[model samples]
Target: METTPFFIFLFIHLSCLVLGFGSVMVTDLYGLMWIRDRVRFTQVISVSGVTEKFIWAGWIGMVAAGIPLIILKGEIDNLMTIKLFFVALIAINGIILHFLHKKVGKYKKGEHVPNLFMFRLMLSLFVSQLSWWGALLIGFLHRHVTTIINWPDMPWLVSGLILGAFLMIWGLGEIYFKVKEV
Candidate 1:
């Protein structure tokens, strides 16, 4: 709200979120489409590879700026802790997915997409979507969604959101595979 230094950092943090998670939507969407057309697999890998750089850059920027944003809030509360937890998830998931990129690279270069690969990819997608979207939602609601739900109810709402989104994404991945086989 303020044009002070903290708010400036906050704006940077939001920009990082846009850069990182926005790229993820593209990667995830193309990855899903790749099931129907092998050529799309290349797009998934290409786009993801290129975007992953910015995603990581944004992640780092968010972290560097986010700590101050939290400190400026001036109270170490539950909501802050919960948000940090999700941020950690996003970071850890990014680390794991960094390695997983090699598998995707191989797939793009004509390596076989085995069942295990698909399973892992689905899981990675879950973590990526869940962490990025989940953290962003929690962050938003923490800041601006108070009109609908009070802060006291946030933990339960976040829990339900995380679990529900994970299940739905997993189910969709399963359905995609099943339908692809048909």
Candidate 2:
């Protein structure tokens, strides 16, 4: 059988997803390590800037490649619709986090730290988890929704829900810790 355009699109889509995810993971890991070690403000700022740049570039690359791929694949169905929603959510959260990081880096000793920045960061992380869960759900539903309806056997949905819950708890913990410090 001849190869379908859908397969081509799928390949490109998956490639971009992998690359984008890897970029984010590397950035987050680096940030976590830097923060844990109590790095200098200038070092932190530089690291954040570099990581943020990678994230933006990866995101833009994904978008630039994904739109045409989706178009070529055909009309958006339920799964694609859901996936798009999560993708949009991820983009919004990323933009918010980018600004929040800038604000956080601006704080100096004796300067009153704004809770709004922390709030925004917390929300962004929460939304990031939501996006991941949504993506997982859409992926799972895409495979078996036409035949299966049970919740337990649905790995994607279950994983997504679990991840979402974890994200909420993580965000709450961060808020609690910050409040204690204040």
- Residue pairs in candidate 1 whose N, alpha carbon or C atoms collide under 3 angstroms: none
For model 2, state the Cα shift of residue 46 in Å: 2.4
> Residues 30-69, candidate 1, lDDT per residue (tens digit)?
8878876755567777788888888888888889888887
| Candidate 1 off by > 4 Å | 1-3, 108-111, 146-182
**Local error of candidate 2 at residue 168 (angstroms):** 12
Alpha-carbon lDDT of model 2 = 0.64
Kindly provide the TM-score of model 2 when superposed on the true structure, using C-alpha atoms.
0.61
Per-candidate TM vs. native?
Answer: 0.74, 0.61
User: Among all windows of ten consecutive residues in candidate 2, which has the lowest summed lDDT?
Assistant: 146-155
lDDT of 2 by residue, 45-127 (tens): 67767766766665676677667765664455545655766777688778877878877777885476656555556567667
- The CA lDDT of each predicted structure is 0.73, 0.64
